[model samples]
Target chain A: MPTDVRLPENDLLALALDFLLSHGLNAPQGHSLARMLVDAQRDGSFSHGLQRLPGTLNTMKHPRFNRHADPAPESVSPAVVRVDAQFGFSCLAAERGIDALIGKAGTIGIGLLAVNNGFHSTALWPLVERIAAAGLVGLSMNPTHAWVAPAGGTKGLLGTNPLAFAWPRKGKPPYVFDFATSAASRADIAMHRNAGREIPDGWGLNGQGECTTDPAEVLAGAMLPFGGHKGSAIATMIELMAGPLIGDRMSRQSQDFDHGADAAPCHGELLLAFSPDIIGGAGVGEGAERLFAGFSDQGARLPGDRRYRMREVSARDGIAVSSALLQKIRSQTA
Target chain B: MPTDVRLPENDLLALALDFLLSHGLNAPQGHSLARMLVDAQRDGSFSHGLQRLPGTLNTMKHPRFNRHADPAPESVSPAVVRVDAQFGFSCLAAERGIDALIGKAGTIGIGLLAVNNGFHSTALWPLVERIAAAGLVGLSMNPTHAWVAPAGGTKGLLGTNPLAFAWPRKGKPPYVFDFATSAASRADIAMHRNAGREIPDGWGLNGQGECTTDPAEVLAGAMLPFGGHKGSAIATMIELMAGPLIGDRMSRQSQDFDHGADAAPCHGELLLAFSPDIIGGAGVGEGAERLFAGFSDQGARLPGDRRYRMREVSARDGIAVSSALLQKIRSQTA
Candidate 1:
């Protein structure tokens, strides 16, 4: 059995920043990456937390990875902000563009920010949550490496292609959800492989296009989108809007760029922000509360409730990680 | 077996327009509804075609139904257009707002149109296709009557909540897809009921929350969202964005307004337009073609191919419907 090791939030953040800085990421990039990893840990989103440190390190070793690249954002129009990530991580790029995105939404009632040429590995909820914090509604989506098949096709042609949404609330956390279009996330499949466990049915097909439960086979094969064709359509939508719509690499191109190196996929992201004050008017908060109450009145949980709950607990008692993983992360800093 | 009756596209449009005008709809409203129904028939989307005329007639009989309301579109901000449907059908409202929405996107790269207090029963494809025709990407979504359950909950609280997306293409029809978040559309369920057939599993649950193939039971109970929890989340997002964000009715509220009379649900519709010229620069159409080719190369049909193919055949051969239904519609005009 793996022992659990608990660490204060600040300690984990410091370790993450140190690891990134030692690995050649600049100050702003390190802070952005470190903050994202720590927040994910704090929210119990372990799939994107400290456990991803080694993957980040591996991606850094790629020759094309520009460790010192600083993203530059340009206002292309009244409601459009375009950011060139310059081959760096997406965290800082998103960070730099957010205020402008929010400001445009504030003034024009809606705004769009498209981040191009960024390696995006973190969960999207954080970015949308920030928009919600500003009392605006946010929608974001991006395509990653192609590892999923289009519906009715046998080959990998779509990415997991996660879609995320956020709505601001009054005196509480915002309503938010971020999820992959795939039946199962790559992280989930990788976890199953690491544990030598069989994946559930409907997750993926073998390379031969036959359904299989073997994680390794699925890794080499193609995952199916959730909800069949509808999910596939959405994944394709994400691919278009985040890829060619922003003049960034499509999922297949992102994977080809890796050349089987297993590094983080480099691509673009699209975020749209809307101001409730301007769009929904004065009753916005009250109206949203009614919907939220409907969920809690029943036993049904809102999408981010569990994560928010975990975040509170972590804030109080710190984040607990498997001792072995904790040691691995600690050694990365050295 | 029901005898098939084939009618020219112009004949069907004329019949529909006459039926609506006779039912007390104003000229513009009649034209809007007639065009929508005919277009749906032309595209082989029978669910929203002339088959819905009887339902429209039934809805018109409701006391609160407004037959002469003219929608008024207001520019709320540089990127937001709000149209008050004045308790009339949404089609004309959408028609009135599209030019403004397109203009805003052309100037600002992104635009949003929110139609409030409208009865939206038409398929969303026609609307998004119009935006695509203007050389822009379009997205539209709206909540219908409450008939869907949250993923883990048994009761209906969410709408079927159709979401539509369209991207312009060169020398071909735009890539478009519109689908309900529910496991199966209410139209499909109603078709099953009318045919005295059992629906497929996963479509819905009985009042007790147990899955059932009986379409009647599901109708009396709740429909399931497509893709389990992820679909449920998307449904919820649609509810928030289309409902509270637009200051319109939620699905439950829409159903409540019908007072169990089953009239078309009066609510709001949200449409967003994005300009590729400003956002993606010069390579969008060509880049999208590459993605489209990838789909064709793998023998994967694009999302809107079926509808577009049907549209061409309908253009050449006209539309086919059952003789019995055609007689019913003809008698309604009388």
Candidate 2:
């Protein structure tokens, strides 16, 4: 019955890794995916957590999927590196490029890594957290298949198009957040749908290209860009930076590449690292402290603070997994 | 009695220059300020246009103002330049550093110019437009005096914290937009107040830390950050990037430096330029065309299209200045 099992952090990670390994993934590949899932679960991002495993496993051995693809870093320039992900998921690709990108930023004050032919249906916080931990500022942008409409138009011309930035502070958790340019992320909409709740106005448009508050219609149609035109512009910016700029397919092109396949949706990401020490002089630490002060003056929660707090709590008490998800995950592991 | 007066663009530029020169500014300094004002007016950005001159004139002759000071570009590294704006207007400083910044970006694939001790109560479009004209991507951010509160906090601790990004396309106006990280820009509130209208909810909070639709109360209280916590986080990001990271003052610190004086607000801006040909590969042109295709398919308006269209008409047909503004300008010129 599974009965809504609560598993220790290590056990969850082991289970995910074992499940992935049985599906033709190498140990390192399995480890990368497992770490991403466990980290998301521990951080209270349940949508990106274990619930995603079953869908991912179904695609892991897709006939057209490159199960053994290995991403290798190619230094396209002194400050830019391009990774050919060989049509694999980006978790392992990011793992392979993180050190190389950081090393380049250390020397040149900045570094850019482009991940082409990769898919990332995962939160970007992990890589950004690592970058910040290494005392560098990190910025990332990526595109999934298109689901968001442009500001004035009803047709979906862009992806939700997430962008992330992170800054590190000594003896404290890094300031980090990854946000979709859409008014609401897919997960938020999914939660509303599951609850049989109406979404807020401006959350999305119906398939008929009209505004609607029904979660189901929005899921079946298009998401609205957040902050109106400003949000749309950013999504376009992300499209350029992560798509053709990186010599990869844009969202629409990726859609064509996969022919609307949910399994192995081909997408791409752009990751950038900047060494605050070189670019910001010695004022980086002082600057971050002052910002912290402002946040405290108003009890403003820093971005990613909630996630860090949740991580600690989950690590201490374990993560609660839904019975349905646990049951499905167990079958895959078996 | 003066009526709404339309004046030729050159005439307006000359008039502004004359007014600044009369305030003891050198020819170059006067021209710098005048150019910014005329450009803003030409683009139909009335708030940043002629309406701002009187306050600027008062600041020009303040006892604490550094009249003869000029910012010079100091290349700190191959990819970064620092400009100490010398407690003067940033129009001239931006003018002085644009060439150096562009050249560096052309060489190194990217350039960062940090403007410290400068005032820029004008639209940032002209500079970004120039960068785009040179076939590069441009990004700018700055913090002025505090006017926006962090999300969930009653106290205002940040500026509107505007961010601008521009991307150039061949044979077309650049895709450019600038946005304040507040729920509503200061100008929007001012317009509502002028029109004797109440603002929408969530625009601002009264002094008592309660939401209010009254523009007067909002002006007396705090402006809400746009998009809730996400907006607050971005404002914080801008605060760090434009303030301590640039070796200058944060929004609150700038407010303190001004001591509530309007004269030379002592704010700063962060400018970055990236060459698409270098970082975005050789397919950038084709890529941009594809983006335009997407926009055309959906009939989405490009961000800077209207402004560019306005500029062209203003250049040919002159700008319509309000009667009050015209009267004030005529008085200064006389």
Best by DockQ: 1
Candidate 1, residue B2: the lDDT equals 45
| Cα lDDT tens digits for candidate 2, A1-334 | 2226667988899988888778887776678889999899889888778888888864665455667877788776667777877767788888788888898877867778888777665888888888888988888888877788889888777888888888888898888988888999888998899889999999899998899999999989889988778778878888887887676777777767766457645777888887778767776787668767877877777778889888888777787677787767888784
Q: DockQ for each candidate?
A: 0.82, 0.55
Off by over 4 Å in 2: A1-4, A61-64, B1-3, B61-64
TM-score of 1: 0.98
Model 1 residue B10 lDDT score? 85
Provide the RMSD of all predictions against the true structure, rounded to 1 decimal. 1.4, 2.3
- Candidate 1: tens digits of C-alpha lDDT, residues B204-292: 99999889999999999999999999999999999999998999899988988989777898999999999988899998888788778
Give each model's whole-structure lDDT.
0.89, 0.80
Clashes of 1: 0
Q: Where does candidate 2 clash, by residue pair?
A: B183-B226
In terms of lDDT, the poorest run of 10 residues in model 2 chain A is A57-66
| CAPRI docking class of candidate 1 | high
lDDT of 1 at B44: 80
* Clashing residue pairs for model 1: none
